[model samples]
Target: MKKPSLTILGCHSSIPTDKFYPTAQILEMKGDSFLIDCGEGTQVQLRKAKIKFNKIAHIFISHLHGDHFFGLIGLLSTFHLLGREKSVNIYAPKGLKEIIDTHFKWSYTRLKYCIDHIELSSKKLEKIMENEKIEVYTIPLKHRIYTNGFLFKEKPSNRKLNMKEIKKIPDIKIVDYKNLKLGKDFMTKKGKIIPNYQLTFDPPKILSYAFCSDTSYHSPIIEHIKSVDLLYHESTFLKEEKNRAINTGHSTANEAACIAKKAKVKKLLLGHFSNRFPNIKAFEKEAKEIFFNVEASEPLKTYYLDY
Candidate 1:
C-alpha cells in the first residue's frame, strides 16, 4: 500500500501576515505531488518546505478567491523561467483559463510547459482526471462564490505475497504467484489453476483526502467527505464570531470541527483563520471542544498519513 503525505503551505484565512501565507496545501501520492489551493507565495512556501517543484504535477484550486488563486500566474511564469518541460494539469473552476490567458497575454510571458486545464464545479461531482495511481473529483462546497472543493483518492494496489506462505507452497510457479497478486487464478502447465484465495491477501481499500475551503456551516458535506484519511476544512473564525462567519460565508472553528467529526476523518486540519485573531490558540481550543482529532496547521508543515 502507498502512504500519502500532506504539507500545509499556507493556512491563514484573510491575509498573509506575521507568520502565515494564505491557503495552499501539497499532497504526495506515491511520488507524485498534488497541490491543493495555490494561494499567494505558494512557490516560496514550497521552497521553504523543501518540496520539489517538478514533482508537483497537478494543482487543484478550491475557489477563485484571490487568497486561493492569486499566486497561480506567478507560479506558472516561474515554471517557464525555471525551464519546466513536462506538462502540468490544473483542475479548477471555470474562467481559470481566461484568467491565466489574461495574465500571460498582459505580461507577454510564454509558458514553456504545456498546461491542461479541467473546469470543475460543485453541482457536478464528476471525475476530473485519473491515472493508475490516483483519481481526482470535485466536491461542491458552499463558499461565498461559485466554489468547489476537491477529493483525491488513491487507487488500490496489488497485494503483496506472504513470502513465508509462498515458501511453504512448493512447486508454485512465480508466475502463478504474480497472477494471484493480480487477483487472477493461474493454471500451471500440469492443469490445475491456483486459487487466489489460498495464495494472496486482498489489497487494502483505497484511501481518500478531501479539501473544503471558505464554506459556511453545512451538513451534506459530511456525506461526500465521509471517512477520509485527511480533511482540511476552513475555519475562519471562532464560535464567538459565528454570526460574522455566517454572514461572510465562512466557517468557525467549531463548525469546521463538527463537519470533521461527522465525516469521521482520521485527522481534521483547521485553517484560513480570520486576521482579526492574532492568537491562533483560540481556534485550536475552540475546535478541540467538538473534534478530538482536530489540530491547527503551520505554513510549510508536512504530515504523513500512513495506514
Candidate 2:
C-alpha cells in the first residue's frame, strides 16, 4: 500500500523569518490532505507548493498561539470565496470555538461551506476524525495552556480478496469473501468453516504518523508514540537556552531528540525554531547527536512519512 506523504508547510518557531514560516504541516493520506496548524501566510505557501485548497477537508489546530492558528480564519474565508460548499471540520482546543465565533461575529464574515468544529483536550486516544481509508486520533502532549497533539494512523486491516483462491472453493459464498477481508472465519452452509488466518493472509501492519507541536520535554508519551513511523516534535531552542525554554514552557533540540530516542520512533522531525539562531543547523547538529533519523524541515518541502 502507498503510504501517506507529509508536507512541511511552515517550520519556523514562534517567530517567523524569511527562510521559515510558523508551524503548519500538511499530511496527505489516501487521496485527501489534512492541514495541521494553519500559521500566517499558509494560503500563499499552499499556492507556492501547488496543493489544491479544496483537497483540505479538515484542519487541526494545536493551541491558541497566534503563530499556530493565525492563518485559519483567512484560509476558511478564502475557501468560501472559492465557492466551496462542503463543510470543513476544525479540531482545536476548547477556546478555539469561541475565538472563531467572536472573530467572525465582530467582522460578520459568513462562510460558503459549513464549518464543523471538534474540540480536543487531554482526553482518551480515540478516533477524532475518520473515513473509509484512515482513522485519526489525538495524542496528549504536555504544553503550556491546553495543547493536544494529533496522531494519524492507518487502521490495521486485511488484504484484498484472492479471487483465485475463492474460485477454487466453489461453495464459498460472496459474503464469506467479505468476511475474509474483515478477518473473520467463513463457514459454508455445510459446516465447512475455513479459518480466516488460513484462507486470507494478514495485511501488513498499518503505518502511523504522530505530530507533537509546541510541547515541553515530555517522556511519559513513550508509551503512546513508541515505534511510530514518523514523529514531529518541536525543537524550540538549543541546550544553552534550556532555562529560557523551560521558563517559556518549551523544549530544546536536545530535549526533543531525547524524547524521540527514548520513544524509539522511526523518524524524528524537529521544527519550531527560535528566530534568535540565524542557523537551523544548530538544531540538526544537537539532535543528530541523540537520534540517527532526524530532519529539520524546510518550508514547502514535502517529506513522505515512509514505513
Candidate 3:
C-alpha cells in the first residue's frame, strides 16, 4: 500500500505567528493530494515546504473562519498569475461560493483555471467524493458555524492471487485467475469447483485518515471516524483552560484524547493550538495521560499513516 501522509503547513488557532500559522494541511494519498483549510500564508508555507502548488487539485475547508480560509483568494490569485489551467475542486460550506465570488468581483480578478465549489451542509454525515482510489466523507462538527471535518478512506484493492495454488490447477486459465482475484469461485475445465478462498489471499487492510478541526468536544463524531488509522483533532487549549475551550467551541488536549480513545483510532494528531501557549509539551502530556498514541503537530512536518 502507498502510505498516506499528512504535511502540516499551519496549525495555530485564530492568527498566524512568526512560527505557527493557522489551520492548513496537505494530505497525500494514492498519488492524489488534498489541501485541508487554507489559512493565511499557506502558499508561503507550501513553497517553504517545497511542495508543488499545482499537485493539490482538491481543497476542503472546515468553516468560514478567517484562519481557516483567508488565504484562499491569495492562492487562487497566484494560480491565475501562474497561468494554471487545471480545474480546482473546493469543498466548503454554503456561503463560500458567494464569498469567493465577491472577492473576485471586488478585486477584478479572473482565475485562469476553473474553480468548482462543492458546498457542504452540517446537517448529517455524507459521502462527498468516491473514486477507485479513495473515498471522502463529511463529519458534522459542533462549532460556532456550519463546520465539517473530513474522513479520507482508501478503497480496498483486489485480493492477491495465490500463484502456487493456481499452478496446481492446470485448467485454471487467465480468465479464471481474474475471477479468483475478484473473490469469485472458479470452475476448472475438468468441471471441478475451486473456492475463491483457496485461490486468493485477502487484500491489504484499507487505511483511513480523519481530519477534525475547530470542533468542540462532540461525541457524535466518534462514530463517523471510528477505527481510523490516523485522526487529526484540534486541541486548542490545555486542561486548565477547559472553560475557555468550551466557550470558544474548541477542545482541550484531554478532550481531544478522549475522542481518540473512544473512536479507537490508531494514532491521534493534535493541532489548532492556541497562541497563548508557547510550549506544546503540556498539550502532549495532557493527551498522553488519556491516550498514549497522541502526538502534537508541528508546521511543515510530514506524518505517515502506517497501518
Candidate 4:
C-alpha cells in the first residue's frame, strides 16, 4: 500500500517573495490528491514540485483570505484552458462560490468541466467528506474571518491473507479467501473451525493528518486532532511577538507547540511565517522548547506519514 504524504507547495504568510510563497499544500492519500489552501503562485509551485494538476480533484480552502486563496481563479482558468473534462470539487467557506462566479462572469470564461462548491459554515468539528479508503473532517478554527482546518484520516483496511498459513491447511481454498480477509473464521468440510487470526494478518495501521490554518491559539482543536500522525499548524511569529500574533489572529511558535503537546500528535510542522523572521529556524527552536517532535515547514518539501 502507498503511504500517505504531504507536500508543502507554499509556506509563507501574507505575501509571496523570491524564497517563500503563501499557504498551500498537497496531501496525497488513498491514491487521491487534496489541495489545501491555494495561495498566490500555488500553480507555479505545484509545477515546480512536479505535481500533476489533473490529480488534484478536491480542494480544501481554509478561508477567504487573499493569501490563502488568491490563486484559485487562475488555477480554475488553467483547468479550462487545458481542456480538462473531469469535475473538480472545492470545499471552502460560503463566499468562495460567488467570488469564482463573479470572476468568470466578468472574464467571459466558461469551464468545460463541472466545479462543485461544497460550502462550509459549521462552527464545530464535523465530517465533510468521505470515500471508501479515507474520511475528512472539519476542525473549526478562529481567524480574522471564518476559517476551518481539515483532518484527513485513512479508513481501517481489510485484513491481509496469511498465504503461508493458508497453504498449510488443505481446507482453506480460494473461495474462502474473502471471508478470511473479512476477519471470519474458516469452516472445514468436517465442521472444524479455524480462527480468523490464524488465517489472516491484522490490517495495517490507520494514518491521519491535520492541517491547522491561520488561527490564533485555540485549544479546542486539540480534541479534533488528538494523536494524529502529522499536524501542520500555522506559526506566524515567535513568542516574543505574542501580542502581535494575537492582534493579527495568528499563533506563535510556542503556542503551536503547546497545542501539539496537548494533542499528543506524533509530529508537528510549523509554517505561515511572518516576513520579519529571516531565519526560519527560530520557529523550530521555540517550538522544540515545548514539543520535541516539531519542525519548521519547508516549501516544496514532502513529509510522509508512515509507521
Candidate 5:
C-alpha cells in the first residue's frame, strides 16, 4: 500500500514573495489528490511540483482570505483551457461560489468541466466527505472570519491473507479468500470451522492528518485533532510577535506547539509563516520547545505519513 503524503505548494502568510508563496498544499492518499487552499501562484507551484491537474478532484478551502484562495479562479479557468472533463468538488465557506461565478460571468468564459461548491457553516465538527478509503471532516476554527480546518482519516483496511497458513488448508479455495479477508471464519465442507486469525493477518495501521489553517490559540480544536498521525497547523508569528498574532487572529509558533502538545499528535508541521521572519527555522525551534515532534513546513517539500 502507498503511504499518505503531503506536498506543501506554498506556505507564506499574506503576500507572495519571490522566494515564498501563499498557503497551498496537496494531500495524496489512496491514489487521490486533495488540494488544500489555492493561494496566489498555486497553479505555478503545482506545475513546478509536476502534479497532473486532473488528479486533483477535491479542493478544501479554509476561508475566504485572499492569501488562502486568491488563485482559485485562475486555477478553474486553467482547467477549462486544458479541456478537463472530470468534475471538481470544492468544500469551502459561503460566498466562494458567488466569487467564482461572478468572475466567470464577467469574463464570458464557461468551464468545460463541472464544479460543485459545497458551502460550510457548522460551528462544530462535521463530516463533509467520505469514501471507502478515507473520511473528511471539518474542524471549526477561530479565525478573523468564519473559517474551518480539515481532518482526513484513512478508514480501517481489510485483513491481509496469510498465504502460508492458508496453503496448509486443503479445503480453502480461491472463493473463500474474500471471506477470510473480511475477517470471516472459514467453514469446510466436512463442517470443520477454522478461526479467522489463523488464516489472515491484521490490516495496516490507519493514518490520519489534520490541516489547521489560520486561527488563534483555540483549545477547542484539541479534541477534534487529538492523536492524529500528522498535523499541519498555522504558525504565522514568533513569540516576539504574540501581540500581533492575537490582534490579527493568527497563531504564534509557541501557541501552535501548545495545541499540538495538547492534542498529542505524532508530528506537527508548522506553516503560514509571516513575511517578517527571514529565517523560518526559528519557528521550528520555538515550537520544538513545547512539542518535541515539530517541523517547519517548506514550500514544495513532501512529508510522508508512514510508520
Candidate 6:
C-alpha cells in the first residue's frame, strides 16, 4: 500500500524557543509536496531537513497569525533569488494578498516566478484543489479569526492483473489482459468465457490525512475528518490548563484527544505546544487516556501514514 508522510518543521506556539520554533510542516504524498504554515525560521528548518526547495508547489496558511505565516515573504524572496521560474500557488485567507503586495511594492522586489493566490472564504467547507493523484479540501475551523484546516485524500489506484492467471491461458491476447484488469470478462475465439475476478485483484484502499490547526474544542469538525488515516490536531496546553486554553481560543491535550477519538482516526499527532509547559510528555499522557495512538510531534522527524 502507498502511504503519505509528514515532516515537522516547527511545532511551538506563539514564539520560538531554544528547542522549538513556531508552526510549520511538510505533507508529502504520491510524489507531491505541500508546505503548511510557514512560520518564522521555517526556511532554515526546511534547509536543515534537506528538503528540495523547488518541490513545494503549494502552500496552505491556517490563519493570519504571525506565528502561522511570518516567514512567507522571506521564503518567497528566497525562491525569487534562486531564480525559480515555475509558478507557486498559495491557498490562504483573504488579507494575505494585500499584505504581500504592500511588502513587495515597498521593497522594490519583482519575483521571477508567478504567485497564484487562492483566497479562502469563511462560508463553508469546499474543494480547493484536485489533480490526478490527490484531492484537497478546506476544513472550516473555529478560531479567533477566519481559520481553515486542510484534508488531503489520495485517489484510488488501479487494479493489478494476475500474471500467473494470464500465463495459464495461452489463447488470451495482450489486449484481453487490459480488459480483465478493468473488470471485464473475456470471450475466447472459440466462444469460451473467462471471468474477470479470476484474472485481477481488488485495488488497495485509499489513504487520507487531515490537518486541524489552531482551533478550540470543536465537535462539529469531527464529521468532516472522520476515518482519516492520520490527523494532526493542535494541543496547545495540558489538561490542568483547560481554562487558559479556552480563554485563548486554543485546545488542551484532553480536548484534542476527544476529537481524535470521536472522529475514529487511525493515528493522532499532537503539536503547537505552549511554551510554559516544559514537560511535553504530560500532554501525551493526558491525551492517551482518551486516544491510544497519540504522539507528540518533534522537529526534523518524519511520521508515516498508512493503512
Best by TM-score: 4
**Per-structure clash totals for the candidates:** 3, 0, 0, 0, 0, 0
Ranking by TM-score: 4, 5, 3, 6, 1, 2
Tens digits of per-residue lDDT for model 4, 188-252 = 88999989999799999999999998999999999999999999999999999999999989999
User: Per-residue lDDT tens digits of candidate 1, residues 1-307?
Assistant: 3478888989887578668789998988866889888888888988988977888789988878899988888888888888999999998888898999888888887788899998775486778879988888888888778888888888888986767766666667676666678787655557876676666777776778888897998787888889998888889998999899989999999999999988898898888988888787888899999899878877777777757
Tens digit per residue, CA lDDT, model 3, 1-307? 4588999999899978788899999999989999999999999999998989889899999999999999998998898898899999999999999999999999888788899999997579999988889999999999898899999999988999999898998888886777787899887777888789998999988889999998999999999999999999999999999999999999999999999999999999999999999898889999999999988999999999885
- Name every residue pair that clashes in candidate 4: none
The per-model lDDT (C-alpha) reads 0.84, 0.85, 0.92, 0.95, 0.95, 0.91
**Deviating ranges (above 4 Å) for candidate 3:** none
Ranking by lDDT: 5, 4, 3, 6, 2, 1
lDDT of 2 by residue, 13-111 (tens): 776666679989899877778999999988989999999999999999988989999999889889988999989899998888898889888998887
TM-score, cand. 2 vs. native:
0.90
List TM-scores for all candidates, in order: 0.93, 0.90, 0.96, 0.99, 0.98, 0.96
Colliding residue pairs in candidate 3: none
lDDT of 5 at 184: 100
TM-score: model 3 vs. ground truth: 0.96
lDDT of candidate 1 at residue 193, scale 0 to 100: 66
Model 2 alpha-carbon drift over 4 Å, by segment? 123-127, 173-175, 185-198
CA-only RMSD, every prediction: 2.0, 2.3, 1.3, 0.8, 0.9, 1.5
RMSD to native, candidate 4: 0.8
Off by over 4 Å in 4: none
Worst 10 residues of 1 by lDDT: 185-194
